[model samples]
Target chain A: MVKTDGLHFQYPGGEAFDFPNIDLSAKDHLAVLGPSGVGKTTLLHLLSGILPASSGTIFIGNTEITSLDRKALDKFRGSHIGLVFQRYHFVKSLNVEENLQLRQYFPSKLKDKERREAIAERLGLKAHLKKKVTQLSQGQQQRVSIALGLIHKPKVVFADEPTSNLDDVNCERVLGLLKEEAKLCGSSLVIITHDQRVTEHFKNQVVL
Target chain B: MKLGFIAYKNMVSKPLNMVLSLLLLVLSVSLVTFVLQLSKQLNGQMDKNISPVDMVVGAKGSPLQLVLSSVLHIDSPTGNIKLNEAEQIIKHPFVDSAIPVSYGDNYRGYRILGTDPAYFERYEAVLQQGRLYKTTFELVAGSAVALKLGLKIGGKVVSSHGLAAAGGEAHDDKPYTIVGILEPSGTVVDQLLICNLKSVWDAHDHGDGTHGDEEHREDESNLGNEEGNDHTQENERHHDQGDKEHDHTPDDDEHHHEEEHDLHDEEKEITSLLVKFKNPIGLVQLPRFINENTNMQAALPGFEIQRLMGLLGSGVKTLNGIAMAILLVSGFSIFISLLKTIRERRQELALLRTYGLGTRKLLFLVLFEGLFLAFIGFLLGWVLGRLALILVSKYIEAAYGYVLQINGPEFVELLLLGATLLIAIIAVFLASTSIFKLNISKTLGDA
Candidate 1:
């Protein structure tokens, strides 16, 4: 579901960094384990096409997303690649259900109400559908972020620093949900975190 | 579903800020449009007021005041013009028709105009009910006057000593009988109590009983080829000067007035002579002709009305300035508010873009917020403006005895709404230029 090779980047008037190749099949779970300042965020950015790489080939499903233009790349990223940011920020004006709908709306302007309700039910977010994400508990907000990432059934889901701030028990619960939901959607899950506790759960691991 | 939802939500998020801009916008729009529509109506009314009479021949003074008093019947007369001297202009070959209007008495603040039946023709006024006056002291009430005074046929109107309805002594002579009522034509005739020239003379004649039974032929004549009856009421007072020459009509106390014409031709007076020319050439020649040849001044009603508008123009300009200032202030407030919003909400923009909203849709979201605000402001202002017009219309009807022409959703109002929205668009665009400079990754990561 995801492949990357020769992924390198150089910032204007700044230092350069070279990234390792990555390969993952459908329903695969990969943990790119590294501490802070090890180019973990940079590698994530390069794979997502958020920053143009100096040289790289990034593929999600059958499409090479690195060559896409700004407009096309945004659409490709919205429909094929989902990112779960570290902070789990939702649109402050929209509720939990609406935020999930908005994720689907990014690629196509259509919102699937039934599919959203099913997904909310599976994620234990049915009762909190109308709640603003900020109004939810820390655990609930994290769950909402996961729901947003997998709601559109993207081919590759990136969890950036997903369990970096959690305890051992909560971290296990979050990583379990991430891997399980990714498998249900046939998406390759990549967890980028500095926490050493996350690596044991994933059979596929890469040291950044 | 529509992208405008987010825009609206974002705008209303800061309720205090949004309300400040909205209130100013509404206030300016309503105040400006209210006064403008009113002036437009007043301007229309002036044209209608002057449609009948081309020129007014009256005693020398301000020509505007003369037209206002004699033609519009809203002001006191500029003294009286001698009927004998004013006759030359009335009898001139260029004159098509003439109606001599005499004003001296009032029935409850409404003027009593003593003129011939030709006055009704000049005004295009028809009798709503009852019959025209047949003899001296017979009166006809105008529609508005009758409705207000609750006049009935055969009832009498006692002449008051002054122009005011209240605080005036009643004339000692027999009260004038209400023989007819004029239809409401939205003209000067709607606010007057009308009778023949003999009615005014008889009312002012005090206790003299000789002219009561005289025929209508005794009224002033040789009024050119046209038939017109006009007389002055300077002698209507109960003083000794009026007591001597007041009885000018023929026959008994309640005379028909036909025989008194030739005998009192020099003694008869009219407040103003309403003149219509045979051709448009009279418009140029008549005013100058009367101003130069006769003691009476010839004032064009159209010209005098424009001068009156000019007199009122300064006040309207000051009001316009105030309305414009407030509008600009509102524009500034919106500009500042929107500018601040986009500046502070860079992360919001980043989130929207990450969700699949393109650069173009981002622009739309910002612009939509402004458009919705403008739409709301204009709607509220339009309603407030129309409300003001209704209130003004009521007051004008009560004070001036005429209804203003007010309508809904005028083309000008649409243009006003369109203009307000356009300004809002420009303001929002100028404020949201920072969107182009935003780096989505940096923005999202920093926040």
Candidate 2:
């Protein structure tokens, strides 16, 4: 479960943003829709503990993430929260399987090769597992990025503009895969994006 | 799976940069190690050759040349001093022992030293085979000279007139019989051929002079003959006592007695006299006294060797400073490369932070890359240093007859390695501090 209350943030010498409260159970999904410079990414950052909120209480699973110290929040985020960025940033030096292995490593979890292969197979990336991330095409890299976000089976997964650069078909396919993976893993999904096409897919929506 | 894997991947991804940095480090480290080893061996060989003698008295010339020729045998003698003039110094009451040395001959490029039996006694050389030289033409070969010349007991060797064999006038009329061989002493004595002073004076006697010079030479020759007779009487007295105590052959005693009278007419001269005084007063006043009062020049081995070392040390110290500067520049290059890499991989690092990798792990990943390069560079440098020392050792042995042990762990090398690693670590730490202030959300949003 993921919940937030009275989330507010302000940049240094910049305008402040006030976010509405959110409540989502496991397997539910939320899409934060906003134009440019509307704090949609800031919401995702606050929700995932990537940026500290000035006055807010964020609960993921049973812990209040905003109250945790930096190290504790890092640990808590690693075990409970997963992040998928828009630009598909992978450690380009590593291969597809090693990227997933790194994600599994940070939470001090066993590198379950079977689970990794299973995730790759589910994302239709079985043939590209040994290939470097830079060698993969756009669609394949997107799928690998989705697998990385869900490899640890976190309780909450926050994605930032995951399908903004895709065509209508790829955008739908990526959104469908993300929703399906989140539902399969029983994870709450919160996606912050400016795209209008993804708004119809999620019933729980927040507009800034 | 581990952070080290990421570090390895990052290093291998840019092979050119990694190799350039490593090559610079290896060159610096190997140069320093080579200098350390060479200087250490040079100092060791020099200290081993510095005998207990206090001063060297020879004809007036360079003090360094005198010490090199008399004590180390690495240079030619200044000139010959008259034996009578040197005998005055020997008769001083404060003198404990005075060993006269004449060096005008060589066999196979090894110097033949004409000295008294006390030369072997002072160096503490024990005979390996046969007895010490008892006659003028008999010789005692050092172990290295014997091995190098393939000489054994009773082997005859003719003397060359100069120190080197090339273009040297061979004294075919005089030949020396190897009566004894000395054991290895790890000193300059190991490369010498020891005989009495009469042998050197007799071999150089050509008798070509004016009538007045001939008369003076004849008078000096008569003096030499008288000294030989006195030496022979002293030996005969000792031999008669030995023959009475133990059953010894009188035939050998007669042969030595006959050989002493042969070639007895020669003008006696010596190259130098190695001196040791009984008190500290000699160290203060003797060299001054000899330089001002006598025709001979006194050369202090310690002072002359210090001058030689000062000349050599400047070159080594300059090279060492250059090597250290190159090492520092290599460290800076490492810092720049790491900083550039961090900037280029900003988005990637942000993505790692998103995946729950902490700042400390990210810092370590970069630090480990630097340390890994240093370790590889250090290993290659160590091997190159040993290889260089081996080559230098061969050259030094061929040129100077000094053996250098090339393979050993030196304390300075370990300290250099530790200092290099510390420099690398500090460089990486300074370069990777950007990771601490990395704003993951802003970076990912910009990307």
Question: Which candidate's lDDT is highest?
Answer: 2
Q: iRMS of each prediction in angstroms?
A: 1.5, 1.1
Q: Indicate the worst ten consecutive residues by lDDT in candidate 2 chain B.
A: B226-235
For each candidate, the DockQ is 0.49, 0.62
TM-score of each model, paired residue for residue = 0.86, 0.81
> Model 2: which residue pairs collide?
none
The DockQ assigned to candidate 2 is 0.62
Q: What's the residue-level lDDT of B167 in candidate 2?
A: 44
What is the Å distance of residue B36 in model 2 from its true position?
3.3
- Report the C-alpha displacement of residue A97, candidate 2, in angstroms: 3.2
Estimate, for each residue in B220-272, the C-alpha lDDT of model 2 and write its tens digit.
Answer: 34223323221222224334432232333333444433444442222246788
Which lDDT tens digits does candidate 1 get at residues A41-81? 77877777666788879887888888889899878777778
